[model samples]
Target chain A: MGEKIKVDRVTKTFVVRDSDQKGARKEFTAISNMEFSVKEGEFLTIVGPSGCGKSTLLDLLGGLSTPTKGRILLDGQEIKGPGLDRGTVFQQYALFPWKTARGNIEFGLEAKGIPKREWRAQSDHYLELVGLKSFADRYPHELSGGMKQRVAIARSLAFNPDVLLMDEPFAALDAQTRETLQSELLRIWEKTKKTIIFITHGIDEAVYLGQRVVILSANPGRIKKIVEIPLKHRLADADIRSNPEFVKARHQVWSLLHEDEYAGLYI
Target chain B: MVAISKQVKSAKRLHKLTINPLLALQKLVKQSIVLLLFFVVWEIAPRIGLVDPAFFPAFSEVASAWWNMLLSNELFSHFSASITRSIAGFGLAIAIAIPLGLVIGWYPIARDLLNPILELFRNTAALALLPVFILLLGIGETSKIAIVFFACTWPILLNTIAAVRNVDPLLIKSARSMNISSFSLFYKVILPASIPTMFTGIRMAGTGAILVLIAAEMVGAKEGLGYFITYSQYNFMIPEMYAGILTISILGLIINYGLLALEKRLSRWKQDPTV
Candidate 1:
């Protein structure tokens, strides 16, 4: 498979006002010289301690923010700004409160320049894909946290982006809901066949979802190690998370994160 | 059987919600029993001389005075005149304030240039500047409308700025990733997000429009509820004065509910109303 995305020596830094010294500025590197590549149709899950720039990396991939020192490429083309080629599902769901579940889905199609007539069918198709066909007319506030996130996923997928960028999409949900969504997301990803980049703080989630887990350490985040999860079965099976291989992969990612010892403080 | 009946009861409630809002109003009317009792006390108090009839006329007397003015077409003329001025001033304030507020809120340059001036004028009460409006615009329809216009501007402007500024950042980020245009971003996301807060300002400005217009009219005017009430008070037509005051109270309520209804319509997706 060809490289779907390449994070080539990318480093993101911010010039924040120095707290101790008045009027002085200091450079804080969120991520330093991060280099990685994702193959076509690969499920890449990134895990890190807090402030390890996992989110900053996602923002760079989504083209919402620019890397301070290096460039990110999608299909070998430099990403200048956010476009329909990539779909993003945020942790907050970020569903338009004024739009219905279907309306939110239709908004993506509209942004993709799909005609008004095809919107209903296309949106309904994606809504069904996320098992939210019944909630087509329901508004964001009327939905549970899980349902809202499902609608967010439906809206993102409805746009038919080649790559799915999810930034801890299930982090806000309850334990049961989060587990359920994780399974559903995997199902959706398999069916859609999109290159997926999932960012999470959970060790089990990273190990379970990713074909390869990119473990990042904090304080100028650099990749500690990338653990490959060789699961016996791949799909939405809750039992798979408890499998021996799954447990082993999860353990590997956990220790990699804890390598710096500061991971315990954050945890 | 008990479970079946409970489901039926909920089904009936659902039917009322979808089909007949009048059935819903039954709940509201039942809650208004205290208001009904207040009217009853008001009717009997003056009749028994618990309150002076010359000053605080019986509820029946006020009703009769309201009826007579209605019969003479005097009520309609004054009502129309007051409504026209209120609508004109209120409409003009919204037309001006909402757009300006969006610009001021969305753009730092506009906010920086106009914020100090806004803070200065916003502090000076519209009622305090009634004389200035009357002095400059003269004691005419222009002054009455101008005073209302002045009073209505601040709330709508401030609220709109707040609405524009406070849109959820994550929502914007999510939309931008969809490759939405800047124009579509404002229309599709920011404007709708701001509607709830802007309506709050509009509702406040609605109250301000009536309050300041009445005051402005009371100072010098010929045909408003304020004028009618003051005129009747001076002529010792105590029932008529009370009737005019009653009309103002009703008008205030109607305007408030009207705005509420509007907010509900615009923000149909808003389950919990902040207002």
Candidate 2:
């Protein structure tokens, strides 16, 4: 019950049934022999190619589904199923379409039977934290792509979960909005300092957001490397894209990825 | 170019205001005209000898019979009895069907187990089983209510299941991630999402329940509009039968309009994306 989380040699396999009339089933290994530990108050990112099962690993860690083998531990206790300790934000902005932004944020608290007066104050606070105070009454369909995600983040954060798990939460947003929300997330992260595990297919985003970025292989998703950033503080959105160290680290990761594809750098 | 586009937008706005309202007015006017034409034809056709006067009574004759029934309070008694039975059956059906449907839809195992039995029972038409209901419960209020319940429960149950099953999985995932429990999950998330569709089911059930009760009342009912219709027809009072028919249709229209208002209130958030 001391450390934040530890993924101990987790291996997840899916039985992909063959569409051929013969009715054969084949095993598709999603994550194999994955081992990692997330420290308390750490921001860790897992990044790889689109089909690399980065999301699957997050699901495994969050106990959305069980792995075929190995176990994930949160605070040295084995994770069994979805619990109050870990909160998730889905990439597709999974805000309930029927609920207003304030309602969605208040839902978790309401489930716990929190008094209406307290829930109102806390929900408003989270809405303000995500800079979506004006959009409190708006439904998911009324909000823009970015606004929906901000509300999603607010809902997850409102419960004050021990660990925050994000699965490429900003991937669907336009580039400008993505970066703006990234900085907003950084500000929120600084204030809360909760343990976070973010999964992404975007390398630059992984490097920018993570204190340590863990890269995984394509299929049979296995951990390849973990790169630690030297900086103590997150860079400003403008500064992040322009910083020499950020650019250099990003290029290095890009080359490592592209090297697997083409076997040589062109420039 | 921007100014021209803005001016074009304004022009389009004006065009919409002029044309859309006229289109809506035309629709309303057209419906009213069709109703007026039907009444006029009915009024004139019998006198002009275009159709048999025996089968088709004059509109004036029907209206006079309606007035007579109203003055004698016979129509009120029949109407009130029919309405009470219909509403009571509908309320009971809703009480049973909605919770059961939600359970079957929310849990896959329950749906898988119960679906075959439900489908088999649903296929047995409520009218065809009227004799069986009469045998089991006697030819009383029990039999009539049983028939209406059978007719009404299917639509409500099926619609509720459809609504619950079709609720977007994304919403469920979001709610789960927020640590919402299994019980509150259904009420807070699933119920709200399923309401518009559930309303459609209940409204359909309301009309079906009334129709079934009318037929049921024809079989041994002492006090109901259906009995009044058959009694008048047997007595060779064509206008009274026509008045009963008109009353039933008006009842249906009121139920439909009431549900429509409720649906509009509940689905305030579901705006057309194209707009």
What are the chain B TM-scores of all models?
0.89, 0.88
lDDT of 1 by residue, B162-235 (tens): 99999999888888998888899998999999999999999999999899888888889988988888898899
Candidate 1's C-alpha runs over 4 A off are A236-238, B1-26, B273-275
TM-score of predicted structure 2, chain A: 0.93
Against the true structure, whose DockQ is highest? 1
Error of 2 at B248 (Å): 0.9
- Per lDDT, the best of the predicted structures is 1
| CAPRI docking class of candidate 1 | medium
Cα lDDT tens digits for candidate 1, A133-231: 766887887677888888899888898889999999889988877877887788887888999999998988898889999988888888878888887
